[model samples]
Target: MYPDIPIRDWTFENVSGGTTGEPVKFRHSGKFFETDQGAKLLFDEWSGRKIGDYQIRLWGSERDIVSGKKDWMNKIYRWMRNEVFLNTFVMSEDVIKKYINVINETKPKMILAYVQSIMEIVKYANLNHIEMYSPRGIMTSAGTLDEQMLEEIQKVFKCPVFNRYGSREMGDMACSCNKNEGLHINTFVSYIEVLDGNYESCNLDEEGQLIVSLLSDYSMPIIRYAIGDRGALSSKTCTCGRGLPMLKCVTGRIIDFFKTMDGRIVYGDYFTHLFYPCTNVKQFQVIQDAIDHILVKLVFFDKDVDNKGFYFEKENEIKKAMGEGTKVDFKIVDDIPVSKSGKRIYTICQI
Candidate 1:
């Protein structure tokens, strides 16, 4: 649609990948930054996050921290925003303790982070009997937040946990309103639709792959972009009264689902329930190798915690859920690897 836009004017680039492992770069004009920031602020204000609020971002990598330290401009910008970055990639006992201490001291107004990173901190707080300062609200992004994890995060943080669904390729697409009902699409910036395998729109409340069309980025127009996520449209209107359409749920990427022995498809969230309140378990991943065999990789907080009892209990639960015919093997590991996209994969189905 953008015929006269100059390629040199595109100032922003977003790198994303599909299951095939090739990286695709999307370009956007500088104007997109302002529009995106405005939409984010508008949605965040509904959750009581406002300007000049203390924002603690549980994000960043080793490279990000190092770069921030080396570049005065980035450091100043972060300081001006009153934002602190806690490196989610570097999680160790001493590092977590320091993070907890800093958070307790700062008492931030907003806690923005990946769902899993915050969940890990919450688990550490519960285990160490450390009391964290209550923030106004916690806004989670970059990954799907399971119901169990949401409940625990709210319980520990004592704040409304807003789930945000977005991909780097499309920027911020949707966020839950204060009503905590469902994620409202940012209609001003993008058009979103749920489509079936045939590329036709799915009926309301029916699950399908999500395809997005970004209206704000004409410099490199994205039309019906398959974002590789699954979700459903809400049949009911949100009580919050926003005219924007609602997404019932943003199930993670299509690869996150597993096939059961009976050929039934089970979502990642279904297996997530197995580790609710996930106090003892530090991290976990479920791999379905075959119709009859499943491998569970886990990392426990305490190396000496009653492994035998824990395994027995979890094995029974897995059997009950997956079926008695399915075999369950528990292997304790130091850590699970993140995906090539730098996001954690919870479920893997080889079959």
Candidate 2:
């Protein structure tokens, strides 16, 4: 249906306050078309090359920067560089000393990273008792920054906490609106659809799967891409008065009931309440290393020196939360592994 519409026709403009203006914010960011092609070529030429992900752009330029010109050849030559470490990308330090060094030496008021890593720091501080923050977004608001732990984190850290959501395929973020909890879609880049389990489109008030469509497609056309995340659209408009469509919430990835050792498939919100309340605990990760065994890695310290009270309390609580007849062991480790993008998954249930 959209075959004739040129990709360059799309532009993200600020229509805040219901006032429509010329499209001034024309710049598009993130992985460009040529960059992905270059990455693929390097992977092919190098004998032992490792390819992380593949990106495709629709009708966008392949240059380092988007050109105002509308031409046929948009692909440009570029190099792919893997970002090593967050703190060290600014300067390289070993992982062991990175966090403490940043907190002690740099001593910045607030620090920002992926959700999982920030949670880890919080857990460590709760167990050991330390404070951390980044200059921006220490307090999550009713607008874009609102979150489950936003209030709790604010009470502890007393700073702004912002929530940002997006994916590589979706182009840019669907961040919390500055005006309210409503998520502002990157209406500039992709078309969004909310769908139910039966492949039917969901209404404004219903929970459903998020189906995204990329408006631009020079490198690769992502038409009606079913991103694993679930979310829904909202009927309410913002006080900020932008007439554009709004998204309500991202429900994260959908899951089926996991059959336990007793042959009962369990699915509910029970797991959310388990570890999240360990107020002082900063980060928690559960990895199913074996069929009947799981390993937990946490970064924390305690004045008790041996960390007897908090440690045992956590283990017992986990066993209770999970259920009976399940023998799971928790491994207290100094470090936890994060994905290439620095986001860590809390509960990695291996089936």
Candidate 3:
């Protein structure tokens, strides 16, 4: 829908499909080249995603725009929006259950799950003494999670929940290393520039918007495109040293961080690694409405999870973070809802 490629006269049928020998020429947005590059990378990354030849079929459907129901415009609107959002959000129950079962059976050392449901799994891991992977920053949703929210996500686990960021347009862009707290930009695929308010190069320690030039897409080349994030470049390099780029003070989206009674800051990355061996958990989310009131939303594996020592363990840990006098609460939600876009925000903060 967005690339806006014009269909040939023969493609005017209700449903049309085709094969392209070369990249699509119509809809050459700046990303045409980069999309090409990413396409190759994607092919290599998930070589088995395609087992045989396939023809991409494009069609139009109607939607109830007023009630946000499905209609032709809505059908086109959905795919026109973002290619990745559609894939991430509208997954089948069987697909979700497959991943859930894999997690339960394998009990991996680390897991990187979305916000709304990751915690449900973490809750289960905690009960079984499973040490899930959690980073020190926000357990951001599919896109970007703000700093304060990242802080709160991390507070759920003693270990840090490392922050990772990327988009369908942009491949894997940045991830915080196990050794360092700073996020390292994946410079192999793209170049990054920070622009000040005046649209000039921002000085070190100065906060500015990020613009990216993707080096990988031949199908879609995005040059000097804004990444919709604000951050400060680090003059001092990191000791962990992967040597791509160092970023500090990343404040793109709004994240709320509150001080507990004892003054500990809450972050999202705090929750990532906290759920590993907790096999009975499905997914979860943590909601903080106030400094004293924190709610734990959970979805379980068997409709009923072992609550035996679950409450006492996390209660003490949370008390340590919020302080001795803070009051905590729990909400057992049947569903930790997903957004219209399908991205799940793990930590919701108000304070």
**True-vs-predicted CA distance for residue 285, candidate 3, Å:** 0.5
Q: Which rank order by TM-score, best down to worst?
A: 1, 2, 3
The better-scoring model by lDDT among 1 and 2 is 1
Report lDDT (Cα) of residue 56, candidate 1.
Answer: 87
Cα lDDT tens digits for candidate 1, 120-220: 78989988888888898999987788677888898888889999887666778899988878899898898999999898989999999999988777678
Score each candidate by Cα lDDT: 0.79, 0.46, 0.49
- Highest lDDT, which number? 1
Whichever of 1 and 3 has more TM-score, that candidate is 1
**Residue 85, model 1, lDDT:** 83
- TM-score-wise, the better of 2 and 3 is 2
Off by over 4 Å in 3: 1-28, 31-93, 97-164, 168-258, 261-264, 275-277, 305-308
Kindly give the stretch of ten consecutive residues in candidate 2 with the minimal lDDT sum.
55-64
lDDT of 1: 0.79
lDDT of 2 at 306: 64
Candidate 1: residue pairs that collide:
none
Q: Candidate 2, residues 241-307: lDDT per residue as tens digits?
A: 6566778876554431233565543432234345666553344566544445546666544323565
Q: After superposition on all CA atoms, what RMSD does each candidate show versus the true structure?
A: 2.6, 13.2, 11.8
- Per-residue error for 273 in candidate 2, Å, reads 4.9
Clashes of 3: 70
Using TM-score as the yardstick, the better of models 1 and 2 is 1
